[model samples]
Target: MGPDLWNANYDELLEIPLPKQVQLTGFADDVAATIVADSAEETELLVWSTIDTVEDWLEQHRLKLAKQKTEMVVLTRQKRFPKPFKVDIGETTLTSTRALRYLGVMIDDKLSFREHLESACIRASKTVSSLSRFLTNTIGPRTKKRRVLLEVVHSILLYGAEIWADILKQKTYRRKMAAVQRRGALRVTCAYRTVSEAPVLVIAGAAPIDLLAFERAKLYNAKMNGDNSNEARARLKKETLCEWQNRWTSGEAGRWTERLIPDISVWLSRKHGETDFYLNQLLTGHDQFNAYLFKMSLHPTPTCKYCPDKIDDAEHTFFECDRWKDYRSSTEEIIGARLSPRAW
Candidate 1:
C-alpha cells in the first residue's frame, strides 16, 4: 500500500510543495520546517518503492535457488573439464575414446541418481510417518521400553511358535503362580515374570540357551541353594507384593466414588426404557465417570459444537444458549419421563 499509494500520486504530490508552502509564511524557521517535511515525505515514498522491488527480487531468487537445488545431482555429473593440451606437459595423452567413456559413465550415474533420489524420498516419508505415529502415542521414557517389549511379546504370542507364549496363556500356569507358597502350584508364566522370578523353566538338554536365559538359570540355581537367604531378599520380596496390592486396591479407591454412585442411579433411570439392562450398565458408567471434573450435578458445558462461543457451566448447558437451545430441547426428550431435570 505504501509504494502503491506513492505510484498513484508521486510526481503530482511532489510538484505541489504543500508541506513546504504550509510552513513557509515568510519566517525563516517556518521555511526550514516546510522544506524538512517535504523532503521527509519524498524520502519515505522512495524507501517504500525500493523495499517493494527488493522483496519481489528476493522471491524470484528463492524460486531459482530451489529449482537449482532440486536438479543438483544431475547437473553436477555433466562435467566440463578444462584439459588443455600442452607440449612437454607430461607423457600422458588425452584420447577421444577415454573422454567419451568418462562421459558415458557420468550419464549412467545421472540416471541412477534420479532413481536413488526417488528411493531416498520414499524412505524419508516412511521415516517421517513412523516418527509421527510414535510421537502421537505420547510415550515417555518410562513407557517406551515397556510398550516396545509388550508389542514384541504380543507379536510372538500371535505369530511365533514360542513355548513361553503357550505357557503364559495357560490358566494352570496363572493358578499355580497365585497358589505358590499358599496351596497348589504357581500359575505364573515367563510372560508374567522375568525368567529370574519364574519358578519353572522347560529346556531340551541339547538346545543352546540365550545369554539372558543362562543368567536367569544361574540366578535360579543360586536362589535354590539359599545364596540369597539374607534379610535384603526377604525385604525386596515383601515390597514387591506390597506394590502389587497397592496398585490393585488404589484402582477402585477414586475420590469421586461417592458422587459417581448417585449419578449411576440417575443414568440407569434415564436409560432404562430406551435400552437393555446390559446397555444401561455401560451408559451408566459413561454418565457417572464422564461427568464434568467427576462431578455429576455440574454438567460439562461443551463449547458450542456449532460455533465458537464457550458455554460456561452445567446450568448454561441445560438452560441458556445464544443459539443451541433448539438442539438441547430435542436431546432433553431422550431422557425417560421418570428422570426429571432436577433429579439429573
Candidate 2:
C-alpha cells in the first residue's frame, strides 16, 4: 500500500486509549511513545503494553516489528537509576541506551547534543579532506568549490540545526563548527593557513557558521509560528548580516580586509566577482607581501623589496609601490577609476 494508506492504518493506534500519563506520536512508519511513572516497573509495564498494541496493529497489516532495530532511552536529570530498565519484545530484551540516532540526529538521554555536534564535525571534516584533493590553494574554480562546501558540507553540518542550534552559544561547540568552516574558507579563498578566520571568511563572502545556524533556527521558529517564509528569511538575513558586520568591525583580525571591503553587505551583493589567486592575495594580505612574511616570521623585514622606504603590504603593493605602479595605472585607466578602497 502507499504511505498515505499505511499512515491512515497507523492512525488507529492513536485511537486506542493510552493512559493519562502516556502519549504516542508517529511520523511515517516510525512510532515514538512516551510514558511517565514513579518507578522502573511501572514504566516498563506501560512500555510493554504500548509495544503490544503497536505489534498487534503491525501484525494486522501483515508487517512485523524489527526488534533488533528498536531503541529506548530514558531522559532524567538524576545521577543514578535504582534499577536497570528493560522490556521484552518477543524473544528479544530491549534496554535503555545513553544515546541513539533518531532521524539522522544523534540524541542523547540528557539532550546535551555534544555527541551530535562532534559527529557532524567529523563528517564535515571528512568532506573537507575529500574536497581537498580537487580543490586546493592553487587549483580549482573558486566559486564551484565554495558552492560544494556550502551545499554539501554545510548541509551535513547543519542538519537539524533548528533543534540543537542553541548549543552554539557554548564556546567549545562554536569552535568545533568554526573549525570546519575555517578549513572550507581556506580552500575557497586560496589563503595561507596562517590567515586568521575572520579575513578568510570575509574574503570568501561567507557568514559565520554559528550565526548562520542561529539564522536557520530563527527562520525555523518563524515559519513554525506561521510567519511568511520569504519575509522571515529576509529579516533574519539582514539581522545576521548586521551581526557579522559588527563582529568583523570590532575584531582585531581582518583589519586589512575591513579596509578593502568595509561594507559587508555591498561586498556580498556583488553580482559578478570571483576570488582568484591575485584577488585573494590582495584582499587577505597573505601573499608574498613582505609585511605578511615578516608577521609570519618568514621574512627579515617588512620593508618593500622595490621601494625600501615603504612597508610592502597589500595596500602598498596595490596603490603606492613603484613595482606595480604601471600595471595599476593601466588597470585604473581601463576601469576609469583610481585603485582605492572606495573604488571597490
Top TM-score prediction, candidate number: 2
Which tens-of-lDDT digit does each residue in 190-281 have in candidate 1?
11111121111110001111222223334455567778645545554444444433432344432222222223223323532322222322
Which lDDT value does model 2 have at 163? 95
Runs off by more than 4 Å, candidate 2: 82-84, 88-90, 142-145
lDDT (tens digit, per residue) of candidate 2 on 1-344: 69888777878877777778888877887877878877777888888888887788779878888889899888775555533457876799998887888888998888999999999999999998888788877677766556656567788889999999999999999999999988888888777887889988887878888998999999999999999999999999999999999999999998888898888888887888788767888887888989989988999999999999999998999888898888999999999989896578
Inter-residue clash pairs, candidate 2: none
Worst 10 residues of 2 by lDDT: 76-85
Q: After superposition, how far is residue 272 of candidate 2 from its true place, in Å?
A: 2.5
Give the range where candidate 1 is weakest over 10 consecutive residues by summed lDDT.
Answer: 200-209
Once fitted onto the true fold, the runs of candidate 1 whose alpha carbons sit more than 4 angstroms away are 1-311, 332-341
TM-score of each: 0.15, 0.92
lDDT of 2 at 80: 57
Score residue 31 of candidate 2 by CA lDDT.
74
